[model samples]
Target: MLLSHDITILSPALALEDCEFPAIFNFGDSNSDTGGLAASLILPPPPYGETYFHMPAGRFSDGRLIIDFLAKSLGHPFLSAYLDSLGANFSHGANFATGSSTIRLPNRILPAPGGYSPFTLTIQYSQFLQLKNRSQLIRHRGGIFASLMPKEEYFSKALYTFDIGQNDLGEGFFDNQTLQEVNASVPDIMSKFSTNIKKIYDFGARSFWIHNTGPIGCLPYVLATYPSAQKDEVGCAKSYNEVAQHFNHKLRVAIVQLRKDLPLATFTYVDVYSVKYSLYKEPKRYGFELPLVACCGYGGKYNFNSSAECGGTVEVNGSQIFVGSCKRPSARVNWDGIHYTEAAAKFVFDKISTGAFSDPPFPLKQACHRNLD
Candidate 1:
C-alpha cells in the first residue's frame, strides 16, 4: 500500500483565486521545456506540439506543459528558452530546462552516462548567471534589458520553478540498474538538487515552486522497459510507482529541511506524484480516455514502440522506420510514452495552483505575492 498524508487539510482561502507575478524563471527537464532543446538541437519533429502551439515547439508533450500553464495563469506570456538566442525575450524570465537533463552528475552512485549533458541543472544555472551578469552590465551602461525589467526586477520579483529529477531516476533505470539501487540513490539525487537551489538563491531568488517526480512506473516508457510480472488494478506497474512514492517521500523531507535552512525563502514542494496519480486512478474524471498509454508511437500495446520514437525513425538493416501520432491527443494523458499530454499537464497545473498539494499549503498566487521586495 502506498503511504500518503491527507492533503485535504488545505484551507479554501489558500486556493489560487487571484495572484500575479512579473516573471517566472523555470528550470527542469522536458516536462517543462518550452524550447530550450529546440534552440540547442534540431527541434522535435511534427506531432510534438500539435495540441496548442499547432507546430513543433520542442516540448516533449503534444502541447503546452505545466510551466506554460503556470505562466499563463500568472498573466505572463510564455517564457522563451534561455538558449534560444534568435527571438528569446528574457524580460518575463527564461526557461532553462532541457529534454534529457538530470539534477546531479550521473556518476554519483548510478552507472548512468548522462553526466555529459550541456543542459544539466548546473549548466542551466551557469547560463542563468551569465544572463544575469549581462543584464547587470547593460543596466550599468544605461541600456534597458526589457523595458521596466532590469536585472534586479526580474530575478527579485520573479517566481523560480522546477520540475526536474525524473531523468536522474530514468537514466539509472536506463543503465539497467535495479529498482532497489535506483531507490537507494534518491538522497544523493536530492542533495544535488538542494545545492542547485542554493546556487540560485545566492543569485537573489527567494520564491520557489519545486515539483517532485511523478509516477515513473506508470509511464508507458517504464512499462515498456521493464516488462512487469504483474500490474496493479489500475494497470500500472506497482513496483515502479512505489519507487516514485519512495523518492517523493525523501524529497519532501529534504524540502522541509531546505525550508528550515532558508528562513526567508518561500519554498513550496508541489505533490506532483499524488495529483498525477489521481488522474491515473480516475482518468474519466479528468476527461482522459487512455491514461496509461502513449498518444503516439507504434507496435506496442500502449503505442510506444522503442524502435520508432514519437516522431523520429531509427535506421536498422538499411531500412527506413517510422511511427505515427494519434489524431486526438486531447483524450490521452501520456504523450509519446514518457511525457504527459497538454490536457493532463493543464489538469495538474490547475490542481497545484489551487494550493491543495503544496507543502505549507499556500496558493502559488499568495506565495509569489508575499515575497515581493
Candidate 2:
C-alpha cells in the first residue's frame, strides 16, 4: 500500500520469509525495472502505474512488474532503484534495471526511435558493484542513512534475479539487422551476460534466478513492423520467435557452464519464454484477450503505433492526440506493445514461481539451495 519513490512497498511485507532470503538484488531491463529508467531520464507518464500505484510510479507497465510481485511474494517491500536517491530505502535490496537495456551497449545511447536507456548490463553491473561497497560505508555511519541501507550480511544472503536480453534482440531488429545477423549475435551477447553473472557470483551472490529472454516476435511493435512476415497459429512472426529461442538456447548453455565454474552458487534458470508464449498462443485459456495487441497504445491492427506509444501526446497537424489505454487491461496480455500487462506478468510470475519451468526444478522459495543432480 505504500508507494515509495522508486518502488511500491507492500505494507505488511516486513515479516521476513522462512526462505531465508533477506534481500533481493535484481539486474535487467524494464521487465523487472522498478524505476531505474524513469529516475535517470524520462518518467513513464500517467496510466503507466495506474493499475497498482494509481499514478506515475516509474514502471513501464500498467501495474506491477514481475520484480514487484517477486518482492511481495518473498515477504519484502519493493526494491528501491539504485539510481533513485529521493526517498529510496534499500534495507532489503536495490534494482538496477532500465528500459531498453542490453547485454552489449547499443551503437547509439540516444533515446530509442521512441526511447532507449543508456544503462546497459555492464553499467548495471558497475552500479551493483558501487552499491555493494558503498552501502556498507553509509551503514557504518550509523544514522537514518544506516537504517535505509541494507545490512552487511544481506549481500551474501540476497536473491539475485535477472530479466534482460530482450532489448538486445529488439535493438538489433529495429536497427534493420537481418534475421541471420541478429541470430548470429547471440553467442557474444550471452558471453557478456555470463561474464556479468560470474562477476556477481564472485561477489558472494549464491542464489541466482535468471530469466531467459521472452518471445520478442510476438510483441506488437515487431508484428506491426513486419506485417507481411510469416505468422504462426498465434499470429506471431515465426522467424522472430525462432531468434528468441536461439537466444534462450545460448543462455541456458551459458548457465550450465557457469554452474560448473561457480560450484557454490545455486542458479535457477527460469523458462519464462514458454510461459509467455503459451499466453499468446492460447490467450483465452490464460484469462487473457488480444494477446498481441497493446492495451495502451494508439492505431493499427494491433492497437499499437510505434511513433506514438501508450500514455503519450502526439501532434496531428498542430492538434494534440492523447494516446491512451483500453478499458480492459487486466484481460490483455500486452501492455504498451513492448511490455506485459500486470495481469500477464502475474500469470508469468505464478507459473515460473512454481518451479515447473525452472532448471533444477526448485521453486522461488528454495532458490537458495543447490540441486544435487
Candidate 3:
C-alpha cells in the first residue's frame, strides 16, 4: 500500500487511474450536501442551484459540491440523497448529508431561526444502517440482485467519504461560545466521529476518504459575525482558525489511531484546510477574484448579512431587502456566507484527487484498491 514517504514518486496523472470502488456512501453536512436536506425539508429556492443545475437542487451552493466532483472523478453517477423519494436511485450510492448538521448528537442551538436541526450525523448513520439492512434483505430474497451482488460485497467494496464537523464548531460560535469553550469539546466531538466510523468499518466498509474540517475562521459569515477578533496574517479570524486547527489535529490523530486498529483498512485523511487556505492566501493563483466574500447574499461587507438568507429577501422593519447572487460564480470562491461555489469545489476536488493532501499520498482512484494481504 502507498505510504506517506512515497509522495516523491506520485504524479498528477495518478488521478487518471482507472476508476475504483463499486459505489460511494457519503455522509456530511451542507459542505457536501446534494439534495438530502432540500428533499427532507424545504427545497432551497432559485439562485441556490442556478449555476450548473439551473434549478434549486438542494445544494447549499449555486452548483455542484466537492462530493459531486469526487463522484465524477471516480466515473460514478452523482449519488442520490437517501431521503429524496422522487425518482431517487441508489444504484451508484446514497448521500446522507444535510445542511446544518452536527457530528455530536444532542443538537446544539444554532443561531438560525429553528434553533437546531434533527438531521444530525447520528440520524444519517441510522439511515445508513437501515439501507444496509434493506440491501441485505434484497440480497437474501434474490429480488433485485438475483444473488449476484451480496450485501457484504456491496458495502465492502464501496468507498466511504466523510465531510462533516464544521457545524459542530459553527453552532458553538453562534451560541456565543468562546474559542476555549469550543476547543474543550474537540475530544468528545472526535470521539463520536470515530465511533461512527467504526460502526461503518465493522459493517464491511474497507476504504475511507475523510475530509478534515476546513479553515472556518476565514468564512465570510465568521468574519461578519465576529469582527472584533484580530485577523490572522492572511486576514482570517485568528482565534477561530486556531480552533479549527486544533480540531483538525485531533481528527488526524484519531484517524491515524483508527488505521493502527484496523490494519487492513484504507483510511485517507484529506487536508481540506490547507487546500482551502491556499486559495484564500492566494486567490489570484487559483483564478479566484474574491476568496473571502460570498458570491451571493444581501448588502454588507463581503455581500453577507447575518440575518438575511441567500437567494431571497426578507422584510426587515417593513423594508424589503433584496439578496442578490453573482453572475460570474466561476470567478468567485465562496457561494454563500458559509458554502463554497461549484468552481471552487471543483478546484479543491482536483487538488485532492492528485493525492497531495491525502495521507500516504496516493491518488483517490489508486487509494480505493483493496489492501488485502
Candidate 4:
C-alpha cells in the first residue's frame, strides 16, 4: 500500500499548530546521515541493523538515526536518501547527510581517520540544486517557477537543517593532533560554516534548524580511546566539546545578527550536544546501557575496528574470517563507532517535541513558529 504522503512529510510539524511543515532539507555529518554513505561505499557491516530492521539500511545506527525519528515525530515518514532512487520520495524531504562530512572542505582532520570527505556536504548540495531545478522543470511544464506561482510565492517555504562539525573535533582530538592546533582553527571553521549556511539561505531556504556539535569527548569511541578521563574531567579533550560549544555560540549570535539584516529569514539553533549529553547521563531512562560502547564491532571496549568495518568478510590467515555481532543491541546506546541506536535517537527527538528550547538566544521552535504564517 502506498503510504500517505503527509504521513511521510507533513504530520509532525503540522502537529505544532504554530509551525508550518516547510520542506525539510537536511545537511550534515554521519550523526544525521540516513544512508548517503553506506549506500555509496561498502563498510560498517550487516549486524549493524541486526536488532532493528533485520538488515542494513545504510544508517550508522542499529536501525534509524535522529533524522528518521525527527521526521516521524514531525509527522513525516522517513526521508529518502539522496543517492537512492528506488522507492525514493522527494515530496517530504531529502537527507543530504554523508558519513564523516564536515562543514569545511579540506578539513584538516577526520576523514583520513574514519570519516567521509569534507566535500560531501558541498557535493550533496550541488545534487540538491540539480534535483530542485529538475523538479521545477517537470512540474512547471518546463517553465520552472514562472509557471508554478503568482511570482511572489515562487520560492516554496523550505527548512534547512545542518548537523556538522563533530568529525572535525573527533579528528583533532583523537587523530594525533594537538589541542593548540585544533583550537586555533575554531574561529576560521565557524566563519566558513556560517558562510555556507548563508549560501543555503540565499538558495531560498528561509527556515533553518542549525545544529551544533554533540559532546565529542563523551562518545564511546573517544571514551574508550582515552579511558583515563571521566566524563566530568575538565582538561580531557573537553577542548573538543568546547570548540563545538564556541562555534554554536558564534552561530547563534550570527543568526540573531542576520535576522536584523534579513527580517524575513528564520533560523533556529538545535542544541544537539546538550540533548545527547542528557541521554548519556541517564541511559536507563532512554532504554539504553553501555552508552559508550557500540553494538557492532570487533574491538574490546568501544566495539570499533579502525581497519575493519561492519559489512563483508575479511580473510584471516589463509582462509576463514570471523564477523562480529551485538548480542543485544536494543539495550545499547551506540550502534557503531560514532552513531547512536534508533532507540537513543527517539529519546533525543522526544526532547525536541517538548519545545523546551523554544526561547530566545537559541530559538529553534520559535524560528519554525515565526515562519508558519
What is candidate 4's local distance difference test score?
A: 0.65
Better candidate by lDDT, 2 or 3: 2
Model 4 lDDT per residue over 1-373, tens place: 2456455344444344445564567888778877777666544467766666777777777777777766775567777777765666666667788787776665443334454454455676787676677666566664533332112232346557778877766667665777677777677677777676666666677777777677776665676677665346322236556666776676677767666766667766677778887766787877777777777655666766655555545566778455565777668767766677777777776776465543233233335554332
**Predicted model with the maximum TM-score:** 2
Instruction: Summarize candidate 1's per-residue lDDT along 255-277 as a digit string, tens digits.
Output: 88887788777888889898898
Q: For model 2, what is the error of residue 5's alpha carbon versus the real structure, in angstroms, after optimal superposition? A: 48
**Per-model lDDT:** 0.80, 0.88, 0.83, 0.65
Ranking by lDDT: 2, 3, 1, 4
Instruction: After superposing candidate 3 on the true structure, give the runs of residues whose Cα lies further than 4 Å from its correct spot.
Output: 1-19, 106-114, 139-152, 315-321, 369-373
The weakest ten consecutive residues by lDDT in model 1 span: 1-10
* TM-scores, all models, native as reference: 0.88, 0.93, 0.90, 0.80
Model 1 score (lDDT): 0.80
* Residue-level error in angstroms, candidate 4, position 88: 2.0
Per-residue CA lDDT of candidate 2, range 169-282, in tens?
Answer: 888888899989999999999889988988888888989999998988899999998999899988999999999999999999999999999989989999999999999888
Candidates 2 and 4 compared: the better one by lDDT is 2
What value of lDDT does candidate 2 attain over all alpha carbons?
A: 0.88
- The TM-score of candidate 4 is 0.80
